[model samples]
Target: MPPSESATRLPPGPDTAVTLGIDPETLETLTYLQREYGDMVGMTKPSGRLTYFINDPAEVRRILVRRHVRYQKGPGFERVKMLLGNGLIVSDGDAWRRSRTMIQPAFKVQNVHRLIGVMIGCSDRRAVAWAAAAERGDTVNITEETNEFALELILISIFGDDYENRFMKEGDNPFAFLSKDSTRDLSVVMKVRALRNLVLEIIEERRSRNEESLDFLSMYMRATDKNGEPFSDEELLDEVMTLVVAGFETSANTLNWVWYVISGHPDIEQSLIDEAGRWVPTVDAVTAENLTEMRYTQQVLEETLRLYPPVWLFTRRSIEEDELEQYDVPPGTDIYLSPYILHRSEHIWPNANDFDPDRFALVEGKPRKDRPYFPFSLGPRRCLGEYFSFLEMKVHLGLLLPRFRMQRVEDDDPGLELAINLRSKRDILLKPSVR
Candidate 1:
């Protein structure tokens, strides 16, 4: 299909502007624009540059799928670059293509399945702590709990034994700062610099050891470009930090939101418990094959992610002229496509605000899959840790939910914290008691 007759010309309107950041106010801004201008809305930035918010499913699909090569990661990623450098999540062009090819195999289902033991180990730590809290008749701070669980899991999955012997065994988790310090300011920047140095030391030690290992670190160390050259010390640091940041935050936010939702809806919590009991009856049964079989557990996680997708808003900039069903897009026009908004859009999802797990029940030729449900994003740039995250989340909730029940300490809704990820502004406090 080609451009429509009107697609040759830009849509006519006053370029109303809106600033969309990963913050609470941006949500209201996006909603207002959609209501006023429909799916495709034109706006001007403070710099007087024109940007478009495309809420149309087909148009969004075209930009991310068929015409992906004509765009790069835009807007908010500039701040991410300070953290990730030119890593796969931020890099584009042949640099991205090369890195994606070399690192793709490490995320294979079989390779990811190998990390299940690590996931179980991490969740066990949480179980120990939560059980202690339950015994004391104390409230479990699930917000911080999931953050530590996820950060520790990814660190171990990436660094293996080094996570304990090096980072955590020194009386405190060095990476704990990531959770406590939300600001991406100079202080946080310095901390990230220190982390990079630690990673470099580890990389050097691994290189000097001259032995084959199977963790993500070793896999990345062994990855090479088209010329059969490995990543330099600097390039390796970029990717390692990217993995640590990207892998941990998203999963943590999802787990935090899961606890919130589960606390509010006892019926769903009971269903999850039953499902967890049937699938993961014991620690030994919490294996990759078993996680896959927990279809109901998967649905619960899907529902949670649908309600609170971590990467809430995605931005792209066109590098070439393009046309959608009803409008023309000139080269260099910034585009905003949000799964957060679309998932909750009443037009796409009926009763969009409701938390109904039945909506995800698998059906023959289910049409929901065709809709925009991209928590891990879509197309080639989708998160590499997607499968790993789901497996880890399932293991965490499955192993724990059946053993302990959490009651919400407060009746008020835990509102959103719109940072790089959608997090709970306040810590979710739950009274943990044995089931």
Candidate 2:
């Protein structure tokens, strides 16, 4: 790769050059960089922007955890900005700080615990649909099944009664395309922005009636900065959009792969079902205490995330001068981190290609103390919904896996689609039977 314009004492890299457009295109390029040069690889993007790929686990932590304040979100977020607007995912600096502070309370463990009922409700809905499919001896599109499960769960969690009274009453979910459509191009962005009117209307009615409820929408509406001012209508709309997209996609993709993995690993699937049987035998029994005891299920989810992190390749930019090892990172340098890469690196994970949940087994009531994993990124910018997503996945698997058994329609590999999110290139089909 060409020495970056600002390249000074940057790490050694080949001048063979690499083009980064996102996906395997980017993945392939980065992998080559790691193979040709050791952990920290630096190069100039074709756009003349200096870029550094940090696969060194310790350095990755330092950039993401210790000195995170010195860097802000970097390249490849332009399309994301169109979808999320100035919401938490796309905003930086004071805007991000204010939004995170205001929205953090809504994800408190106590708050997420209250949504257990909603998680079960959505999983039960999937059970109902799967039951009908099983009776008919029909092939189930588990990709669609998980997508609907997560989409419905997030909507109900956010809107509560409004999900039924408002969104359902209007016919199909206006945001359903998010699950069905994979491309995050202009068409999708336009569709996402158009929902602003629907969200804005909801906000307006809530303001008019002084509505209050135990749901994300209400919490977001009431969220105030240290100044004690609530989100403006536009800011509130962006937040709602961000919530829907955030809550829907990653979890859906995870549940999609969870089913695929379990289908392939019957032994692991049996363990998960047995764990669920012991811990969360029924909907009413899904207490936070019981779910916490479901460590094996958490392992399954973590392994799946390791294999296919949704937001696979992410970027950040340095805001101030920083040092990594002996190298100097000038301001405006772009940095890339990939959990997908790290999670599967042979040096980092033994037999990295294997699907093994045992690797994540809890030790003495905690995750193995030093496992280098960050499927949810790290530090303050770590996904707030980490707890919520895990519970949601565990609940889905706990309830559904016990009630139904699925066999992959064909034993062919469902290749990967590595775009903004890493997904199975083709919809995974399975024949289901009631357990």
User: Each candidate's lDDT (Cα)?
Assistant: 0.85, 0.89
Candidate of highest lDDT? 2
Cα-lDDT of candidate 1: 0.85
Residue 336's lDDT within candidate 2 is 92
Q: TM-scores of all models? A: 0.96, 0.98
- Model 2, TM vs. native: 0.98
Q: Please, what are the lDDT tens digits per residue for candidate 2 over residues 1-435?
A: 456456468888767455676777788888888998888998887687778999999999999899999999988887788778888988999999999999999999999999999999898888888899999999999998888889999989998998999888979888788888889998887888788888888878888989689899999988899999999888988888889888888999998998999999989989998999999887778999999999899989999999899989889999999999888899998999998899889999999999999999877867785868888899999999999999999888899899999999888899889987888999999999998
Candidate 2, superposed: residue stretches over 4 Å from native: 4-7
Question: What TM value does model 1 have?
Answer: 0.96
For residue 47, model 1's alpha carbon misses the true position, in angstroms, by 1.0
Over 350-372, each residue of candidate 1 has an lDDT whose tens digit, in order, gives 99999988888888835357667
